[model samples]
Target: MKKTISFITENFNKSSPDLVGGFQGFQRAINMEKEDIIQEIVLSGLKGRGGAKYPTGKKLMQSAEHHDKEKYIICNADEGEPGTFKDRELLLHDPYGVFEGMLIAAFAINASHGILYLREEYKYMIDDLKNALNHMRSLNLLGDRILKTELSFDISIFLGAGAYICGEETSLIESMEGKPGRPRIKPPYTLEKGLFSKPTLVNNVATFSTISAIIRNGYEEFIKYGTVESPGTKLISLCGNVNKPGAYEVPFGMTIREIIYDIGEGIRNGNSFKFAQIGGVSGPLVLPKHIDTPFSYEDLNEIGVPMGSGAIIVVDSDNDILDYLDAVQAFFKHESCGKCTPCREGNRQLLNILSRLREGKYSQEDTINIEKIAKTMKYASFCGLGQSAPAALLSAIEHCPQEIFKRRD
Candidate 1:
């Protein structure tokens, strides 16, 4: 079996007391220039775990530079992506670590408030997270003048109604403002205008957890885990047709074949691996030919795959690829917020085509139209959802064509 390279999750235990000493580096950073804190994080080479893979340090630096306003820090704990459950585990077992990361982020950007945009499905984790926050407050780790320093940062958990799009930063902000969950346009990106139209820094659940580890252990130790191009560890939720379906924290540079056979213990019930979707539905579709492809931001990006949310869903040979694509299209069609023309219309069109194809009634025109619509969505869609929905079908057309169409042109 392939082994795991656990770094952030090394001390995972549900009953352990909230970490008391890990806040030292963050505290020390407060006494120095805010730029110094941002520099330390930049050196760590941590990318956004929320699928965008944007440099965490660069995002923090931009937020840090905006010193005139009350910036906000957000932890996107909405684990809504299909096959992703690593964030839920983090909150249940390491609530303190999450808080520590939020605190560090708040202090780094000189923000006074922080929010954890938790999904409603994980509502059971609220009490544990709340209790951990209350405990940290009492210990002077949170709330006014943290650790007896000038920095006074506080954090709170905000529950989200069950909406997949709410996991998006702008949509989460919209939901927080009591509006329907939907993504906002860019140019004034979330880093500049987010959370009540203020400068906000949003990160995924695993992103914040990893932040605590970097602050505590120093970025050098964290950097040693992954490659230079995509340094540091990643928490991947590996499921579907795997003998072992669970989360594993591993370094980058491992092949998909290694992750499936070694870490996931191979396909379930002796079924052969057919393909895998890395980074959830919004991520890229992998084929048998690409099994040896390294699992890293650089490697995956080169193949036009977005390392979305770190979810690896394996599909075995026994499963129906046409039916699978239909379900995938249905998800995007249902979850689409309908604010934009492209995502709303595009996903619906894809679903209709998938349905026809599933019924063995597809044509040459359907095949040609599929790629054209996917390209349109990719280029003209307003947000990541619409832009990313075409990945699987597009990959299928180019890679696994026989699996998608009943009659070829």
Candidate 2:
């Protein structure tokens, strides 16, 4: 069967019939019953692709249910994960899809304002999004009286300084408000108190982009593509030693073997695959034994790893796993924001321990101490960054235990 969605397939490349018709379809769908749209989305089982994997329809429903006078829709385009760049690709080639998705979300939640919180490093995409916004405005798809309806919605592009933590919804809102990007405590979730302390629906760019297609095709149709739980498709950025390293939109339950071999064309230069990082830096490292493990949030979680940010970094036997762990430790240390002591000091200490180990100065006793510190940090850190920072290291220790052991005389 021919695939409907493929890796790197630019859905919004040219002014084709489908592209023009998609806007018209969205305009018509926006006028349809909001409850029906919600039902369709719920049936679709679309989850947030921005690492959290929260139900998109459920999030919109919460915002809709808690509709105060001022509700907002936020498109999280701050693709800050180190190895991930799929959102950047979507924004670059499919800006219209994202805009339509935002509009659909705004219509669902009765929101007036929409903000695309994009990263500053995505300069080309930012420019392209701005131009796309202008095009939508020219066609009267945005602004007051959208598509001749009473619904008045407008989208603004809010640029973010290159901060990884800001990719979190709360931090993104804070950054957009001209404050330092620090994650706020949950409980009073974004749907309750978000940007400007109003009810906001913040979703990733890819998650929102899928909304239009879901609304147009119905939820059941969308669900036909992937597993019952992880419905629809996922775009994963395959990098590091892959022959055809790029973005690939595959079904959710596809194995790592399928991704690396079928889609990625196997390892480069015939190098044997030793291990792989299923998610971004904050995700766990999977050894060759877990190659058959399906790529899904639940599957990864069951195995004590997370498919966070959908970035798979393959490592060969020749690569030093300890060095990779050290790099991960350093990344968390540098990006910790120093908001809380556990993360602030914990990451620093962890990096120091890893550095000492690298210099062949740490014994097994030091390794035990390092593990203890990581456990403390996991429980005490303020946000996901600090909490999951030790995952890479821990997974490395589990799979490559001998790598950390010193051969003494």
Q: What are the TM-scores, per candidate, against the unseen true structure?
A: 0.95, 0.95
Worst 10 residues of 2 by lDDT: 1-10
Query: What lDDT is reached at residue 153 by model 2?
Result: 92
Error of 1 at 92 (Å): 1.3
Q: How many backbone clashes does candidate 1 have?
A: 1
lDDT of 1 at 382: 87
Candidate 1 regions exceeding 4 Å error are 14-33, 407-409
lDDT value, candidate 1, whole model: 0.84
lDDT of 2 by residue, 278-390 (tens): 76888778888889888776777788887778999888777877788888888888888889988899888888888777777777678898888888888988899989988
- The segments of candidate 2 whose C-alpha lies over 4 angstroms from its true place after superposition are 1-4, 7-10, 15-19, 407-409
For model 2, what is the C-alpha lDDT against the true structure? 0.80
Worst 10 residues of 1 by lDDT: 14-23
Candidate 1 per-residue C-alpha lDDT over 1-409 given as tens digits, one digit per residue, 9 for 90 to 100: 6679757786577423344554555566667676776787899999988888888999998888777557789999988889888898888777777777787788778887888888999887788788777887877877788877777878888999999999988889999999999887776898887888788899988888888788777889998877889998899999999998898998999988889999999998899888889888776578888898899988887877778888999999899988888888899999989988888998888888888888888877888888888899989988888888888888888887877877533
